[model samples]
Target: MTDASLAARAVALDLVREVLRKSVPLDDAFDAHPDLGALEPRDRGFVRLLVSTVLRRLGQIDALIEGSLAKPGLPKAVVHDVLRLGTAQLVFLGTPAHAAVDTSVELAAARGAAPYKGLINAVLRRLSREGAELAKAQDAGRLNAPDWLWLAWRQAYGTARARGIVEAHLTEAPLDVTVKENPAAWAAPLEATPLPTGTLRRPAGGAITELPGFAEGAWWVQDLAASLPAKLMGDVRGKRVYDLCAAPGGKTAQLCAMGADVVAVDRSARRLERVKENLARLHLTAELLAADVATWDAGAPADAILLDAPCTATGAIRRHPDVQRLKQPDDVAKLARAQGRLLAHAVDLLKPGGTLVYCTCSIQPEEGEAQIDRLITRDDRVERVPVTPDELDGLAELINERGEVRSLPGMLADRGGIDGFFVARLRRLP
Candidate 1:
């Protein structure tokens, strides 16, 4: 193999180690990898595909590795990561057996773990021969997700629905966008299909900025489920709306296009800069603030608040497979407490009789339903607005028993599945 190609593989190995050992998110590690930018574009793309494929199919890959192994545990993290990536290349990515084995051996030697070079070669070669049959024997959905999270989903949704979610995560997400103007007008131009909940879906490939309507800023990328919360506001034109914790601002742009006087607030100034840049691209204007919404005073309550609180974000597991890999039960417990606080503070930031919509890209009920239920129990000053079937274009399956929109990844199985999102709308008492 060429030195550059081998170096690219080294970087991929390091990134996998970064996630498995350090628990750093896969994307964060990939973006922050210092040597990644120096590689050839083809190598860069290879590295990206390698790392994400390893993460996405980690459960199945690990199973294949363990089954090939004489025993259960790997001796070193570098060994584990190297074998995992090699197994991914051989079993799932259709990499040539020789290239996967040779490079994996080289990677282990370069990492100062030369002792296990033979093991990697033996395992990867074995995988090349028997990997396909071994892979077929494993339960992919259960293997890919953390046990605690799988159990949580199974308990929250029944076994059948949970299986659907895990299997959905096995496939990558499609390119979904929120159009600023007449949705139908842009649909044919973009060659996109309009989703039941209103976002447009197209084959997810190529640079988004180079797309047809992009130059004119007619649409911005947003998941179908992520776009749902903003629409729950119901014609925010001319209303004062606050998009709390809004960065990488898809919802903020939606509010601006809806003609709402939008103030998008997030804790990080640097993150908010991206929001400002997006709004400029779309020719949409909004008030951008870098402040913690939990305590930052808006001085006056908002006409409506869209609190997209931080959570475990298991809903976007397909796009961010690291979420299920790196995150744990403690992470969920910690984030749930924070979401609860944000929900209460967001309620306080609303004008009496004003609207507040809370959402999270999380399948966890603690971050979604439980937060609302607690708010309604303790804070009698607010009442459920109960999103109706018509509100979401007659997709009643997306609604929960309490009338909140509990969109699971399993919904829309024929078309690519949507992200798992939980949205609830409420009105403050006068």
Candidate 2:
């Protein structure tokens, strides 16, 4: 194998180990791994695919490994990661068996698992032969996702839909982007399909930076469901909009694109820098503040407020597969409390006649519907604005009975599913 290929594999292996054993999110690992960016573009792509594929199907890969091994337990080291990636290639990636086995053995030895090199070789070879049939015997989502999350989904979505959610998580997400203006005009030029919601959808894979209009910043990567909350604001031309917890700035960009003077607030200075970079690229401007959204005073009441509060991010597992393993039930409960606080605080930031759009990129009702319900119940000023069918491009199914939007990964499956999101539009009392 080429040196670049070997280096990429080693980095991918480290990322898998970091997520599985150390509980680090894959996105954070990618940001932290210096070698990943230094590699050739092709190798870098391979590393990402290898790491994500392994994470997406880790449960089935481990089950296949356990079946192959004569022993019961797998070590949390180089040997284990090597075997996992090897299995991923053999079964999921459709790599030639010999290539998978040889590279894995090489990687195992290089990673200081020299003692387990023979073990890695034997295990991978066996998996290459029998892994597919064995994988069929496993419940990939049930095995891969943490039990706490699995139960939460079952309780929240019911059995059939919960199963569908897990099944969707196994597949990688499509590339969906929001544009500054004229989605159709840019869609054909960019080789993208414009969705009913005005977001452009493209097949997943390829470096987003390499895509046309990226450097020019005509469009930015934002999930179809994620872009909806800003649309719920109706017309915000010249309106003051406060986007709480707006890091990475997808919705903030949307609000800015719609001619809103947006104030984006978040606690992390580092993440807010990303917002600045995106705005600069898109030639859109927003007021950015590095302060706690729950406590930071906006200096003036907003005409509209978009509170995209933090949650467990279970709905985004298709894109961030590592979330399935890293997020715990306690994480959900803790975030729900924060969501409640943020929702309450956001209400205070809105003018009496303004819109308060509460949304999360999470599917959890506790973070979405339940939080809003509580806010409207206790506060006389808050009431559901009820998203009309016309606002969502006639996709009335996405709007819940309570007039909230709950999008799952399973939605729009034929055209490649969108990310799961929950959005509720509320109005402040006059």
Note the clash tally of each candidate: 0, 0
lDDT measured at residue 6 in model 1 versus the true structure, 0 to 100: 92
Query: Residue 318 deviation, candidate 2, in Å?
Result: 0.6
**C-alpha TM-score for every candidate:** 0.96, 0.97
Name model 2 segments beyond 4 Å from true. Answer: none
Question: Which lDDT tens digits does candidate 2 get at residues 198-284?
Answer: 999988998889888999989999888899999999899999999999997999999999999999999999999999999999999
lDDT of 1 by residue, 114-219 (tens): 9999888899989999998888888888888778988999999999999999999888788999999888888888889988767889987666777888988889
State in Å the error of residue 98, model 1.
2.0
Residue-level error in angstroms, candidate 2, position 297:
1.3
Q: How high a TM-score does candidate 2 get? A: 0.97
lDDT of 2: 0.88
